[model samples]
Every structure is written in C-alpha cells, then in structure tokens.
Target chain A: MNSDHHVILRVVSKALIPVIALFGFYVQFHGDFGPGGGFQAGVIMAVAIILYSLIFGIAAAMRAITPGFVRGLAALGFLLFAGVGVWALIQGGDYLDYDALLGEEPGGHHGQHLGIMLVELGVLFAVSGSLVSIFYAFAGRVSEIRDEDW
Target chain B: MLEFILERGNYWAIIGLMMIGLYIAFAATNLIKRLVGLGLFQTSIILFYISLSRIDGGTAPILYGADLESGHGDSEGVEAVAEAGHGVADAAHSGAGELVNIYSNPLPHVLMLTAIVVGVATLAVGLAIVVRIREAYGTVESDEVQEMDLSVALAEAVDEVGETQAASGAGAI
Candidate 1:
C-alpha cells in the first residue's frame, strides 16, 4: 500500500537519502577521530533505505536490492571479518593482529588502526545487510493483515 | 537526605525510567508495546552508564595537543611518563590557556555501543517473530496464543485417549 501521493515526502526523501548515505560513510570511516562508529553508521544507512522503501514501496526497494542478495551480502560481510582474522593468523601473527597487516612504525598504533578500519567495514556491511533483510521480511508479509484489520 | 538526593538525581531518574520500562515490557499485553518498553529500558540503561561515566569539568577523552607533544602511550617506565604528563596536564589545567586531563572513562562508552547494537538486533528479531506469530495465529496477544496452544494440546490428548480405548476394545474382543 505505497501511497502514490505525498509528492513533498517523495521529493524530500530523494534529496535526503544521498546525503544520509554520505553521512553514514563519514561516520564509518571517521570513527577513530570522532564519536560515530560502524553500528551507528549501519543503522543510519539502513534508515535511509527504509525511508526510500516507505515512500517508493517495497517492490521498488526490492528491485534496488533483492532479498537473496541481501542475505548473501550479510554472510559475505561476516566472512570478510573472519577472513581478516585468518589473514592475521596466516601472516604469523595472532588473530586480528593488525600489526601484521602492515610493516609500519611498530611502536605506533598504525597496525591497530588498519585492523580496526577493516573490522568496522565488515561490521557496517553485515549490520546494514541484516537490517535491510529484516525490513524486506516485515514488508513482504502484507497478506498477514489488511490496513483496517488492526 | 536532601544532599544525597541532589547528588544522585541522575541515578534516581535512570532507575525510575528503568522501572517504568520493565513494568511495561513485562505487564503489557500487546507485542509491539512490549518491544517499545524494551527499547525504553535500553535507553535508560545507556543513559545510566553514560551518567556513571560523566566527570565534572572534564573534556572529551582525546589526547590534546599538549598531551601529544608530551607523548603518551601504554609503554614501560609509565611512572616516569605519568609523573611528567601529570605535571604538565595539571599546569595546563590551571593555566590561562585552559586545558584539563580529567576525562570520563571511555571503556564504558565503547562497551555500551556494542550493547546498543545487540539490543537493537534483539528488538528487530523479536518484532519479526511477532509478525510471524500474527501470520500463523491471526493474533499477537499472548493470552490468545496460549489459548490456541491449549486447545491444540487438548485435541492431541483426546486423540491419544481415543486410540487407547479403541486398542483395548479390540484386545477385549
């Protein structure tokens, strides 16, 4: 039951979604120097998409991002995190030892910074994917109830 | 008593919020309302931890320019470095330029971030399950679900009894 009306909402959402997505990326990458982080960024990213779906309808949203792809994306994101840890192990360092990721200044926190960045990327991917999938699941259940049934 | 109350006002508010959230989450019949209560409880808990970490006249938990120039790390010979850093930080704090070493614990804030993510996931999954329940049972009420379950149980029990009776009657014949 996507409202074909609400011309104002549609226009505003179209303008806002890109800016919100940019803000999400900013939060994801600038977390070390600032307050925002993967979880917050992921939620914000999901919110923008959900808002799009809210205005444009689930059919359009699904076409943009299908349910199956979303599920696979979530799994891949988790694997990316694990793979980073395993890469550390293969590099002869402890699991998730970002120090092993590069040969920067050993005393500095360069390696740790790299590792954290990678891990946060994984977190962003998995979190956003799961949220989108959850939204898709909730939205697809239209047969569960009619609008006035409640 | 008044002094104690004033000193711990934040904590008291947090506790009050917690109790209200718990009451609605446990006592409410509607699933969505219960989830909202859970969200409220989570907000209060986050606030409570944040309050605990607040330090009066403290700045952000970041090493300032002075701190960086002085150099600080989780290194050995920490006592010497700590003494040096402390003296500089203290002097800066009292100086006209304005600097402070006092910072609220960052660990609690970091841990709470993880907790919030977990809480959100739990809420989302819980709501999804609620939706499925509505699909299956055509109702989201806990009492209605229980009643449906009871009827299903009663029917199974009656079926079992009928099978035993038929078996016994055939054996007697």
Candidate 2:
C-alpha cells in the first residue's frame, strides 16, 4: 500500500505529536492535583509513537522502538516492581509494605513515596514497552500469501 | 451565563466525540475498523479527562514567582486555594483581586499522559494481532476469515477420521 505523505497533515501531526507528548509530561509531573498521573501519561506517549509508526512504516518504527529490547524492558519493569515487594518482605514487613523498607515516623512517608515512585516507574516500563511489543507482534507477522507460494 | 453555556457546550462536544467513538467500535466489521473504534474510544477518554480538569478560568497549575498575582472573588469553580498556614502561597493567594479562576489543573493532564501511552500500546497490540491473523488466513475481513476457519476445521476433522480408518484397515490386514 502507498504511504500517505500529505505534507500539511504530516506537518500538523509532527507539531501536534510533540505538543501532545509535552502535555503528557506536564500531566505526569503535575498529576498530584490534576486528573492525570503516570498511567495516563504513559499511554499518551505510546500513542504518539504508534501514530509515528502508522505514518512511517512498522519497520521504521521498530528501528526507532526496538521490539526485542522493549520486550525485555517490559519484563525488567515487572521484575523491578516484584523485587521491591520482595525486598519489603525481607525487611520484616508484609508484601509491598512501604514502611518496612524505612524506619518509623517521617521515614515511612519517604519510603512510601519512594516505593510508589519505583512502582510507577515499573508500571511505566512494562506498560510502554509491552505496548510496543504488542504493536510489533501483529505488525511483524509474515503473510500466508508468502506461504502459499512456497 | 455565556461562559457557562460555552463550558457546558464544550463538555457536550466531548460527549459527542465519545459517542462517535463508541459507534465506530460497534458498527465496524473489519478488524482494523474495530481497532479504529478502540482508538476513538480511548481518545474520548483523554478528552473526558482534560474536560474534567478545567476549572473556570484557571491558569496552568505551575507556580510562577512569589509575586504571582492573587485571586478574584472566591470563584465557585477555583478551589485549589493555598491554606493560610502554609507560608508558600500559590497563585490563589497574594491578593484575591488579581485571581482569575481559569487555571488548568496539572493532575488530570498528568494522568492523561499515562492513559495516552497505554492507549497507544493497546492499539499497537490490537493491530499486530490483526496483521498476524491476516497472515494466517490470507484475509483481514471478519466474516471471510470465519468462513475460511470453518472450512479448515472441517477439513482437519475429516483428516483425523481418515487417519483412524487407515489404522483400523492396517490392523485388519
């Protein structure tokens, strides 16, 4: 299929995609009060990449967002989160108990926030990379038409 | 009153967009169309989050310099007022006169960022599955693919029965 190279539309998408990404960042950092947080921001960022892939080809996108690397990264992200929870268990606390990681008092809050941040990062990694992986799975398949010829 | 109408009107527009997305998802038969529907549905969610974040006339929640001008009449809409005890007063303080209840809430914007990322990932996965299915069946259309699958299944079943009969004949011989 011929690719769409509509200059105006392309230009608009180019300009808007970054703006959307920046907006996601803004939401991510400022979500304490606003309606957003890491979850929503990650999705937006993924969409931006997906749109880029759609405009360009999947191969080009894979070059930009390596499917293999991302799959590993997604696994790593989950592992990191699970690791944190396990660490808490070792610290004489229940699973995912932030306070156990740190001592009592204000330290607990700090540990909690830190734990949450790490968890959020894990979420970001798994979510964003997995999303890319999913895209690669379908987009990367070899067609049956090729098989019929063989 | 005009501002109220405009605000509400924008909300309605967002709702309309959501409905359109839902319609696309439900009405389409092609797998790609369904993916498109999913995208529309997700986009509507982003819109909903953004729309809900708008407090009438609020500025973006980023705190500028300390002199950041103060508030107007206790606007019913603007509610993120800085408490008096906290010495670090935000834009909501300074002087109530300078305030304009139009600031943007940073929270929704942040959350939407993650949501958008997730949405893209979902789209990528869905499209990838569609592509793979197309590869396997030689077609991307839903009904045709189903028809092809049914025939293939029938053929497989016949092959299994034939294999069983052949084993029985071999034993009898």
Candidate 3:
C-alpha cells in the first residue's frame, strides 16, 4: 500500500505518529495540573492509532493492537476504576473514599491525589480501547463503498 | 436595542446554532445528516456551558501564585501585568482594598468535558447502527427504510392470510 501513491502522506504520517502518541501521554499525566484529563488524552492517543490505520491499513493497525487486546484493555480499565472504590470499602470507608486508602490523617491530600491518578489512568485505558475498537468495527466491514459513490 | 443584542452576542450565536442543528435533525432525510445535526446541537450546548463559566475578569480555575512563580521565569512579568490590570478593575467595580483573585467557575467546564465524551460515544454508536442499517436495507435514507419495513410487514400479513384460506379449503375437502 505504501509502495506507490500518497508518498508524502505516508512519510509525514510516519514521522508524526510517534509525536502524537507522545503528546497523548503528556496530556494523560499532566492532566492533574492542567486543562487535559483522561478523556482528552485517550481520544488523542486513539487518534494516533486511527491516523496510522488511515494511512497504512486496518490490517496493519490490528496487527499492532488486536481486537482482543483492545477489549481486554477496556475491561481492565473498568476493573481498575472499580477496584479503587472497592478497596476503600474494604478498608472500612465508604465507597470511593480515597482518604482511607492512603495517608495517616483522615483528610490528607495524599490519598486523594493517588485515588484521582489511578482513576484517571483507568479512564484513559477504557476510553482509548473503546474508541479504537469502534473504529475497527466500522473499518473492518466487507464491500466498502468507494469515495466517488458518496 | 443594538447594545442589548451585541452584549448578548454569544447567546445569540448559541441559539442560532441550536436551531440550525434542531432543524437538520428533524428535517433531514439522510441518516448521516441527522447525526451531523445532533452533533452540532451537542456542540452548541457545550459552547453554552463554557460561555456560562466565564467571569468578567477571571482567570483559569488553577492557582497561579506558587506554580507560576516556580515554573516559568518569563511568565512572572505577564502575571504581574495581569494582576495590575485586575486590581484596577476590582477597584472600579467594588471599591476594593484587598486584592482578590477571581477564577472562573470550573464545575461547568468539568461537567461539559464528561458531556463531550458521552456525545462522542453516542455519535459513534449512532453511526455504527446507521452502517448496519445501510448494509441491511442498502440505503441510509430514513423514509426509504420506513417504506421497506412497511412493505415487508404487508408481505408477511398477506402470507398469513393466504395460509389461513388454504387451511380452511383443505378442511372443507
């Protein structure tokens, strides 16, 4: 597919894909102090994958991150998020009571910070996985209509 | 009248966008067009919430004192200028003696972020369903899909009636 046409597209996208993914990670982690968060970061990361698939092909993209793996990521993320809440419950606090999860003091910021980070990480995984899988579902269909048909 | 209209220009824009979106969602025959309309409507609502969060002389919800001082050296001069400007405005508005840091409300912004995510997911699901519909009916037009469904239902009713008549005839024999 990369042999002939869209040479410029292929080259530019190849260079840009890593940079885009890096920016996604930056957004994910720096979200605590800035405007970005898990949702924005996840979408940005998913865009990198989607862009690659658009330039290369779905088959190549799937090879890098298979459907099964994507589904597992989504499930794992949900579990991670719920796990935090459940952990708080087990520690004799109300559900999602992050203060009990960490810190010696009842209302310390440490526990809250840790809880938010874990939850955001979970959201990041779930959102990115779901988006990529949705893209795959749309693109993997047989007998695609040509652009001119539209 | 002009002053009133110009002062509320952001709201006017939002209303215009919302109406356009609603019109497309109701009047468009193409399924894709309807989804596009829904997206536009969602976007307008998001814009409205963001606009509501704005304060006349407020900065972002983040604390600018410690972080700004420690992180960027150049931003100190900018921050000082902004503080000076705000001080003047504050004096004019409320006869201020103490410096007050006004920050825009962050709650609406956070809620809208979640709304935006939900909107994307909804749009994705809607488009996926539309794709399946097109595959099954070979068309994405709402009217055509309804017509095809009506025809299929009619055919099924005719078949049932024919079977009943044939059974009655066989019983008579």
Candidate 4:
C-alpha cells in the first residue's frame, strides 16, 4: 500500500483516473443512442475509484470518498428513480409512465427522453455508490497478509 | 454431422463452459474458488443470452439510414422520423412491404445488462462474507470451517451433558 514503491503505478493512475471518470459520464449521458448505459457507466466510474484505492491505499481512497457519502449517494439515487415514477403517478398516469413525466401530449417522445435520462442518471449514481462502498467494506478489513504473502 | 456441429458451435462451447462452472462450484472446497465458479456460471449464462439475441446477417437494433444521412449521428434523426409522420415501427419497413434491415433482438441484451450487474453484486456480497468467515475461522476452506463448527458443537454438547449430570447428582444427595 506504500505509494513510494509504486512510483510508475501512482503516476499512471493519477493520469488515467480523470479520463476514466469522464468516459463514465459520457456513457451515462449518451446511453439513449449508444451501446453504453447506466450500468456500464456506473461500473466504469467505480473502477476509477477502485484503482485509486488499489494504488494509493484504502485510507487515501476513503478520505477521498467517505463511506457515509457513498451510502447517501446510493439512497439518493434510489429516491431519484422512485421519485420519477411517483411524479408520473401524480400526473395521473400509470407508475413509470414516462409519457406523463413532462405533461406533454400523451406518448410524446420528449417526456420519454427526459424520463429515461433521469432514470439512467439515478442508476448511475446507485450502481457506482454501491460498488465503491462494497470495495470499501472489503478494503477496510484488518489483514494479516502482507505484500510478501502474494 | 460436421456441418451441424460447426453451425451450432457456439451452443456447444456454452454448454462446455456451463458444465465447467457447475463442476467447479460443486467440487471446490475453497469458498473463493466456489465464488469464482459461480462467476464463471454467470458469465456463461450472459453469453447464452447474448447469443439468443443474435440474428443472421443482422446489425444492431438501432435505426440506421436516416441517422447516417444527418451527419450529426445523434438521436435527432429518430425524432425527425417521428415528426415526419412515420411511426418508429413503420420506418423499419419499406413501402415495398419488405424488411429493409434485420436487427438483432435488443431485449435479451438489455435484460442481461441487469443480470450482469446483479451477478457482480452477488459476487461482492459473497466475497465479503468469505472475508468475514476467514477472519472468524482462520481459513477460507469450507471443509475446515465445517470441521471447526462440528468440534465447537461437540464441546458445547459435552458441557451441557456434564452440567445436567451434576444437577441430577445434587438432587439424589
């Protein structure tokens, strides 16, 4: 976990993490027209954090993202998703009826687009938060195994 | 027989992978190895679902011609088509009543995306449990943990039997 020993890894990961995060954002937003989506984007984003933790050590990663924050993020994402569905219900349509989301003409494409985007954003948040937290839970454990053990 | 096997080779490979995964899961005494086997099984199932979505000479399920023409290469073309009074389904068919594009089914692919995420979560939870087990029992082997549990149970049973015997002896006195 010592940063001094992994000079090359530290330098390379520092350079790559931002780009990986940017790509995750692109996938999250452009999911409507592409092969990528919330799940892919979420995993990609989580990988960046996991890589950071692996190279820089778990304490540094936890400092950067805190367990409490990630837990909140997961809850917030679920709320955003369910809130959208509830919004549709309040609009007098069936649950998750994206057409009712924007008060546009029933079955309008715009509402569907907006609803899908919001829902995917929620999924992105939930997936990334949950994954990073799970990584934290594992990394936070006290280990008797050392680098020599590998 | 050769042609038939060649044509359906993917299925054969899937079956092989599935059997390997199943064998590992059932036979491996190490908890981590069992989890790895479970992951392999999940991967093979994902591959199977993907193969089910494939169509001969089919491209992705997206609409192409109009979008290709726009040069912007965005979802605008889809909206434009809808605005032009063609329902999304109608656009896939030409006026000659023949299919212009054969698109692979996207449903299975979409469903499998959820499956993959669920599989990862399952793996993570399983690993966390294994880590806890290792911490508590000092080993990741399932047989070792079970043996330890059996010894503890036998010790507890002996203690209870001795205590009961002492109580009976006191009553007799």
Candidate 2 chain A TM-score vs. reference chain A = 0.80
- Evaluated with DockQ, which candidate comes out highest? 4
Encode model 1's per-residue lDDT on B83-119: one tens digit a residue. 5665534433443333336777788888888898888
Q: Rank the candidates by DockQ, best first.
A: 4, 1, 3, 2
TM score of chain A per candidate = 0.90, 0.80, 0.93, 0.94
Model 3 residue B72 lDDT score: 47
The weakest ten consecutive residues by lDDT in model 3 chain B span B90-99
**Regions of model 1 farther than 4 Å from truth:** A1-4, A148-150, B68-100
TM-score of each: 0.84, 0.55, 0.85, 0.88
Model 4 collision count: 0
User: What value does the interface RMSD of model 2 take?
Assistant: 11.3
- Please tell me the interface RMSD, in Å, for model 1: 6.9
lDDT of 3 at A7: 88
Q: Interface Cα RMSD per model, in Å?
A: 6.9, 11.3, 11.2, 5.5
Looking at model 3, give its docking quality level.
Answer: acceptable
Provide backbone clash counts, one per model. Answer: 0, 45, 0, 0
Model 3 root-mean-square deviation: 7.8
What does candidate 3 score on TM?
Answer: 0.85
